[model samples]
Target: MTPHSIVPRYRCWSKKLKTTLYTYPENWRAFKAQIAAQYSGARLKVASSAPAFTFGQTNRTPAFLNNFPLGKVPAFQGDDGFCLFESNAIAHYLSNEALRGSSPQAQSQVIQWVSFADSEIIPPASAWVFPTLGIMQFNKQATEQAKEEIKKVLSVLNQHLNTRTFLVGERVSLADISVACSMLWLYKQVLEPSFRQPYPNVTRWFQTCVNQPQFKAVLGEVKLCEKMAQFDPKKFADMQPKKDTATKKDTPPKKEKAAKEASKPQEKKEKKKEEKKAAPAVEEMDECEAALASEPKAKDPFAHLPKSPFVLDEFKRKYSNEDTLTVAVPHFWEHFDKEGYSIWYGEYKYPEELTMTFMSCNLIMGMFQRLDKLRKNGFASVILFGGNNDSSISGIWVFRGQDLAFTLSDDWQIDYESYSWRKLDPDTEETKTMVKEYFAWEGEFKHVGKPFNTGKCFK
Candidate 1:
């Protein structure tokens, strides 16, 4: 049976409902809604392949994007045409009152832990586990850092689960389900016996959650990691792009060879130009694409704009090496070009939707990475403030032109529209104070109520 096949218990508390979920097979994000449906009996049908859905192809279609603006799964659509994206939101919608919480405080607590699962557990887990599964390449420092963060998360969960079977209240709720699902790959990939032994409480809680009939029906029997898995060079190599392995055909006849040779110069010239234009497409490739594009020598997007006296590189160095409030702020204002550069303030339009601190930070990081070609012309200090479920992301950007720089290139458009951008006047004390807070990563902001939780810089 499919992971999302409806549970036998059809005595759903709500009216009989029909809905479809789109995702790839065995995707833990989709599993949240599926497993919740197992308990709530919501009849959450899944379409993961072929005619109903295909990962990259179906998701990119205009029809899908119309319903799900981000084109991300696991997207959900009710038979009534209600649409939802973001796995957590979709899962919450499918969960029953019992699974959601017994009371208001319980509901808040449940969502809190759910946010905890996303913000705390998943980032480090993926960093360590993806490499082991050959889904990503590994770096020793990153792996070690992931291990430490995992240990810290497990310790927190261990203490919390020591006296209780579930994350919130007395019984299974979205909190327990979300946390267990978040840890699923960790248990399956790298948290072997010895490594996991220190967090017996977390292990016990995980086992208890997974063994439930609801989880079992959706996830099957999850096998714990027997021996810690390591990245295999062979598997990683195999995932890399391979040339046409079919044997080359024999040499063509003299006439055919001459015809092909005659087309070579233009073909080579066109191919070279194609590579230059395609440089920014790497942003859409994968997470590692950003790393691979570390020094992508693309055509400068700001080439049409006149040179600015405000040197972005020198300011970046000043911010990096010296005190931000003293050196960087002074350097910025001293060289501030009212006509040559423009300041803009941007905030995520969907603050209520941001549940993961790391995920929020990644939005900043991803935008920075994708804007690689814009580096010669722009700088931004994007910040994520407050904690999970109650956070907001805002940034201060300096661009070479008066208008929004993202508008200059289609490749840079992926993340810009998600934010509401406003041009800021650099001369105002308000703008200078905002710049200091964001640049120095200090001081209070009346907007967010306090300091930022994390921040990223696009230099």
Candidate 2:
């Protein structure tokens, strides 16, 4: 029999299996597993609060650590004594075959998207959203980079979901659950309407999933971000451990109080000195993190350049919200400022080294993420022009300066060297035709010998 038709070894692929979940209240990670249980009709009793499970105290206990070696939350304990750690694992175990995927190929695709959520989505989502929640420090550079990374990921997802409702198999699989939960914080805290306007597909899919009865059972009445959250110094400071202000109230005589005050100034000075000495060791855990919790000072590389009449942000909006060929392309030429800005053609030098189409796309995505800082002053349309093992990477890049903008900062230098770059003359009709083709992603370029596989826009 084929994998899809094959019967399971066990007669009972028990959807309603009894289990207990250990985690803190309102954890997005735990929500997936709980929501999976809701889908599968699994009996999952969550131990989120005191008398059931205390987060720091209970997780550190020997009993808890034995089941979850890492002492991680959302740990599952089955009625049959089977235990599972990691939110994804628990969610998968709790999911019915339909949610996990019925066939082998379907199952693999489910895992692929789950891995995407963990690797591609969660890291950047955490970096950007945690600081806003006062859960972590915020660094402007890191947060900006994280925003770019998330946008690229969303762009990929947006295109994938453009033609469908769900991530895989046209059903609400673990992939959708995992990815949505991973992005919960971003949606709730930072992905405001203005910010998320570009990725309409992602937003639609996310809203559809969350509004489902099963999902709402776990994550009740989801709210989209209206205002983008900023890192609050006071909020972060409040999260810090409060000092032991509760002191002994032993009644001392008036004379004793007078004597203590007389010596209090000297004692306070010594204590302050000790605090000054110890503060750096504790506070300087991560330089980037400290900056994230507080404002960091850095000069913009594009600050010294003369202001161009062409507004990059306005063009980005046009390209994202309106038709590229009809509106954005026409707008670009009308406000063309060749002296202040330059268009460049970049092609990957090592085509033979490229293998999978996904990997090639990732290489483009990675380059785009690294060039996050460039988003403010640049735009690019990087495309992969083949399938499977045979593919090539090429892109059209627009930057604020006449020279290569990568040389302006150390941060932008990472991926530019891997590609061969040649400045395109804006005045030439050849350049104008190329811009229209690349910007719209529709042209018969006899130069590149492969069909267009996939493309990513960097704005």
Candidate 3:
């Protein structure tokens, strides 16, 4: 059996700090609260500071590094020598029984809502509040955009909560616990009066969760605090320099004078003409098609080629393109573990390829799927294309030796070597850029550009 630690047996070394639990004094404090409650059955060994450790600062002492190399809090080390990052995964492992659910449908619903909470709620919430709180310094326009997007997502969640009392089944589950903790991070500081006024259901649900006995046991009285109304990016930019500020102060006035002397209303006409004359973006699909004339390199993650262990060529040769594209790929049967992860790919059916637009939509959906709590051990997949409708590619990809991907590896590397596989980065800007490229691809093919359509695959 694979090495696994139940919630009761986890938390070998760290001690729980109860005073700051679940209260959004800070992100770490809120997360600590959830982890402590989830594994309340376990005996904690040591205590650490809470709510005071700021990101990119503090929490980097030698004591902290012994647990998580990244110095990220909410990380745990088990008596069995297992350690891991990512809060959702740690919390799930700790609350093993409460998280899995009592029934199959209930389990699926739990995972679904947990995922919905993470992807839909957390992103916009962070984007909207961080800048306002001075944690992140963002421009006014950028801050406003983030707030608006957050409001839209909150509206969606509010509507969903209108009928359901909890996120998943009637009783509270890990879905509610994890999601409520995430929401509580900003509930006091970010969810301003006006936004809460319209989303009464969300407000009520949040309040009820906080009032629960278990919740209150870990987190005491909630505080009503006002956060900064606006953020100035220049504030952070200015934080690093005093002398540099003097130098910059000397330059803007001269630039303003120069700009005033060079500008006129008539120049607006010339600027518009110049904008029209700008060259269009070089078409990437055209490049791919042109490149395909020669032997294509295995750089594209979507390209159908053979790699070791999971042999793409063998699978392709074993089944015709039509069959391979349509058939559901097999699963590991057991859920993903620290040893590895999984990815699922699909090609556009009729065109026998994918357009950039649909290709991006597919990648986005895959990204969201990987965000599921059950799939938390590894990073998300990379989706790319071979060419336009004439040809395209898609695959479930994982880096070798990664928690999720490592488990899926055969050690022999035989099957994977048969496929044209390229290593992909989970954290690079290029990855997102490639996804956007796929989504923005326009061509003779129209249907391949449709919005993403999601599918269900059980392992």
lDDT of 3 by residue, 1-459 (tens): 211111123323233332221111234323533544544454433233344443323334565566566444455555565665566666655554545466888888777766766655665565555555433334333345456766776788789899977777565677777777767646766666765778888777777766666566566655544543455455333221122123455669889678667876668888897556332211111111112212222222222323334433233222222222223122221222222323322242334434543344433443333222222122222233334344333444433243234224222132223234445453454443432332223222332343322211111
Local accuracy of candidate 1 as per-residue lDDT tens digits, 1-459: 432332234346483668999986677878888988888878788997679986656776788999997666789998899999888998899988888887899999998898888767876777678767655555454467679988989999899888987788766789988999888888987899999999988887788778878999999998898999998767555444333433335545786678679989989999898688666443223333323333234455666878778887788667655667778899999998888889999988998888856677666655775665565577877778887678888878998988999988766899899999989988789999999887766788877774567443222
Q: Rate the local accuracy (lDDT) of all candidates.
A: 0.76, 0.76, 0.45
lDDT of 2 by residue, 1-459 (tens): 321122222123375557899876677778999988877778889997779886656776788888787555778998788999878889998888888988999999899998888767876776677677655545454477688988999999999999988888766888888999988878988999998999999998898888777788889888997999998867655544333433346536776678788989999999898677545433222222322223233467777899899998788667755777889899999987898999999999999998866567657755665555466688887778887688888889999988899999865787789899999999898889889988877798667899986343222
Checking candidate 2 for backbone clashes, the offending pairs are 137-292, 138-292, 138-293, 139-292
Sort order, TM-score high to low? 1, 2, 3
Q: Indicate the worst ten consecutive residues by lDDT in candidate 2.
A: 2-11
For candidate 1, the lDDT comes to 0.76
